[model samples]
Target: MAAYTQDAILLLGDSLAQGKFDRAGLADRLACVYVRKMDVINRGLGGYNTDWAIPVAEQVLAQQHEQHRVPRVQLLIIWTNFVHLVNMVRSPASAYYSPNTRVILITPPPVNTHQRTDRSFADTESYAEAVKEVGAQVSVPVADVWTEIWEAAGWDELACEQFLFDGLHLNAAGYEIVFNSIMKIIEERYPEIHYEKLQTVFPHWSEVNVNDPRPSLVKRRVPIV
Candidate 1:
């Protein structure tokens, strides 16, 4: 694999960004030769929107330079789950979209129509659009998750009772689907390439096993989706 001799990878975004859904340890499952379990940093703060994401990303990006690795940011995953928050920061120059980092915006998962009525669907679609617009301004790639869920199960089934035990977050299989979806995007775009950088090798996959007790939810899925 082509060596990305970088160590730090900051994943900054909202609840979905926190990656609370993927019990499969999705980030650990990435096929990046430059990145490994230890290298991927979960900077995802539950319930945060892009308004909050910018500062966190800035803080990390400002002092976060590398000595050995060439900054293996083969992928920087982002998702926006907050519209009210982004609205609060519309005119602020401190918004999340910045040119300093490589980025990919995952369309925030769709809202559960059954669980959310009262214009939540509008809010979610608006949020998704806002995310895409901001990412476009900075020339970042957009990961179309809106299509992913809609095409597969539609909002109702994707947000069905069995799919979400808590009526918000997905169960194990749901999480697996989410994780695989994101990874598949990365693999498709980055197209992992093998290279022998003298002493370099892929980092050890996470030691965690499937039987290990599941981790807690770091971020709540909006609208019980």
Candidate 2:
């Protein structure tokens, strides 16, 4: 087999998961913590819902035969609405069924009705609940970001303004809640792949031999456990 470098964590979702607008988005935060341990791949698309994400996932995820050449996806963080996407990876009948890949579902944050007239507060709440339901049915761990942000805002729909900048998209404070929620799930359900538990692919600077640094620079494989 060819030399394997680093394993990866793929983040898939809409704009919220994309984190292009906010520097403190979940993907960025995870990268910071998981640096050198695992590569974080963000595949979030703007304004895309469940329908659009399914096809894109098909294209992005490697097929069974191509798995050898590509970096293994150790963790897949899905923020989009999916029962199909989960099936694609978890179902034995599917081509993308990756037994080694761990999956986590994330709910969209609550909408701020006070600042936005397009989306209703009830509707957004229902959407979050639906994502949780899908996660339950599919047996995938859920981050439940909706509930976390709501509780952070003291359960007031109007008070969600503190987290959301434009009533729809999240600001720094909002993304902080998201990062925390995802980390909690990782620590509880997927501790093996947690940053603290894994070693870096490359040796730390101090581990390098001053007389022969080349030998110390060789990458090491970080086992899941």
Candidate 3:
């Protein structure tokens, strides 16, 4: 295993979060933007809801004792909906609590019942709203993806096909919205960790002196606000 040389932005959620097939998925976009600044770890599991996520989080998150060896989770982005999951990390009594870690809650995208039957439009909408409520209760930032996509779809359920591939999962267009929403949240809530504000772990090649390249290649700790 690679040594813990950088902090991480851990992403946890359901299929919407996993999105291994979508090149424009949230994880992919975040990885691209956060490269060299922070490692973006995707722990998104397909078909997993809040209930299934609880047990999984315990395993994925480092225990208090393991803090010294593991990369610190500086930012956590949860695309799942549930208060328990949020409290598990934010609550002072929880074992995984990290006071320095910032959290961002993301609402699920809108569902179009017409193209999909397993889920209902209203049900998904409720889940999205619940995420926002949890974010408010815990004082974490929320990426209100539901409302943003709904508006992008012109408030018409059927029109969501422009972004969604099967009225359920997102396409490149949909992922773009998710990526934009996340970037906006980061800009407003965690400006210090923003990609633009952070310096690369190693100096740019242009800064390296030809006769003394070893010193410029040394990795440096990134300052976080």
Global lDDT scores for all candidate models:
0.49, 0.88, 0.86
**Candidate with best TM-score:** 3
Please name the candidate that would achieve the greatest lDDT relative to the true structure: 2
lDDT of 1 by residue, 71-168 (tens): 43434566664333232222234343323334466675556656544436566668778777766665555676555655556556444444444444
Sort by lDDT, top down from the best? 2, 3, 1
| C-alpha lDDT (0 to 100) for residue 58 of candidate 2 | 98
TM-score of candidate 2 relative to the true fold = 0.95
* Local accuracy of candidate 2 as per-residue lDDT tens digits, 1-225: 756689999999999989755478888999999998888999999899889998899998998889888989999988876799988888888999888899999889999877999888888888889989998888898988899988988998889899999999999999888888888888999999889999899998999999999989999877862
**Candidate number that wins on TM-score, 1 or 3:** 3
Give per-residue CA lDDT, model 3, range 158-197, as digits (tens). 9999989988999999999999998888898788888999
Better of 1 and 2 by TM-score: 2
TM-scores of all candidate predictions against the true structure: 0.59, 0.95, 0.96
Clashing pairs in 1: 1-195, 5-69, 5-70, 6-69
Ranking by TM-score: 3, 2, 1
